[model samples]
Target: MDEAIIVDAEFVAPVGTTAGEFVPIDRAPAAGLLLLVAFVVLYAKVISKLGKPAIQEFLWEIITRIVPSKQLRRRKEAQLRAIEVHTQRSNTSSQDQFAKWAKLDREYGKLKVEIEDINNSLTASKARFFTIISSAIFLSTTGMKMFLRIKHRKAAIFWLPKNAFPYPIEYILSFSSAPLGSVSVSAWLMICDAAMDLIVTIFVALVVGVIGMLRSNKVKPKTA
Candidate 1:
C-alpha cells in the first residue's frame, strides 16, 4: 500500500519576486482592511452617541411614518381626552347626580382599556422595528468581515521585519495560512481595529475634558 503524502503550499508572489516583497497589488488588501476597521470604529462611536433607546426610537418613528399608525395614535389621544372630560364631569357633579357619575366612571374604564390596547400595539410595532434594524446591521457587518477574510485568506496585507517577534507570536500573527513574519488579513484587521478604538477613546476623552474646562470657566466667578 502506497502512503498518500500531503504537501502544504505557501502563498507565492509573482515570478522573480520574494515572499515578503512589497508589490503594488498589496495595497488593495491593506486598504480594504484599514477601511473595514475605520468603518467599524466609526459605526461603534455613532451607535454609542445615539444610544440603543434613541436608535430604537428613531427606527420606530420611521416605521410609524411609513405604516401610518396615525389612526391608532389619534384614537389613543381621543381616549385620553374622553377620560379627562369624564374625570372633570364626575368631580363637578353633586352627590344627587349618582347615575351620571356612574356612567362617567364606566366610560372612563372603557377609555382606559382602549388606550392600553393602543399602547400595546405601538410597543409591539416598535419592538419589531428595532429587531429588523438590529438584524440588518448584524448581517451587514458580519457579512463584510467574512467576505474579506475569505477573499484575502492567502494574501499578505503587509510584511513585517524578519524575525520581528518570536516564532510563536509570528505564527499567531500569520493566521489563516499566511507566511511567517507577514501580517495576514486577520492580524492586520485586529491591529487596525485596536488602534482605531484607542484613538477614538482618546479623542472622546479630550473632547469631554475640553467641554468641561469651558463650562467651568464660564461658571467660575471672576476674582476681585
Candidate 2:
C-alpha cells in the first residue's frame, strides 16, 4: 500500500516546489502563469469586441429557427392563451406560479424570433473567441513548462535559438522577486519579439482582409 501511495504521489503535480515555485505540469513561477492567463483573457476580449455584431446576428438567427421554423403562429398564440389561463389560476401553490412563468417565458421566446436570430451569431462568435484564447493559453502553458525544464537543465524538447539571448529568468522562479534597474539585453530581446508578434498579426490580418474586401466591394453593386 505504501509503495502504491509513493507511486501515486510521484505523478501528482505539485503546486509549488520546495523553494516556492509553481509549475503547471512542471514547476513554473506564479508571475509567468499570471501573465499567460492575462494574455488569454485580453485576447478573448479583443476577439469578442471585433466580432460582436456577427455574434449578435447569429443569436438572432436562432430565434427564427425555434419560433417560426414552420411559422407556427397558432402554437405561439396557444402559449399566450395558456399564460392568461395560468395567471388567473391561483398563487396558492408554487407550481402554479412556475407554470405561469414558464408559459410566459415560452411565449416571449416565440415572439423574439428576429432578436434570437441576431443573437445566435453573437453567441457563436463569443464562444469562438473563448475557444481561441483558451487554446492560446494551453499552448503558452505548454511552452512555459518546456522553458522551465530548459531553465533547470532538466530536459530540452527543442533547441533554443542559436541567436536567442538567454536571461536568468529561472532566477525569478520565486515570489520574492522584482524587475531590476537597467533591463537585461535578453529582456529587451523578449520585449521586441512580443511587439513584433502583435504588430505582425494585426498588419497581416488587416492587409489580407482589406485586399479581399476592397476587391469584392469594387465588383459589387451598392444595395438600396
lDDT to native, each model: 0.69, 0.46
Alpha-carbon shift of residue 154 in model 2 (angstroms): 10
Query: What TM-score against the true fold does each predicted structure earn?
Result: 0.65, 0.25
**RMSD per model, one decimal:** 8.0, 17.1
Best by lDDT: 1
lDDT of candidate 2 over 30-114, digit per residue (tens)? 4443354345434544443445455444554665466554334544564566556455444335465777666656655554564
Q: Which candidate number has the best TM-score?
A: 1
RMSD of 2: 17.1
- lDDT string, candidate 1, 13-104, tens digits: 45555444623333234666556655864666545554667777777777667886775777768677886868676686658787777777
Compute the lDDT for candidate 2: 0.46
lDDT of 2 at 190: 46
Which residue runs does candidate 2 get wrong by more than 4 Å? 1-202, 205-215, 222-224
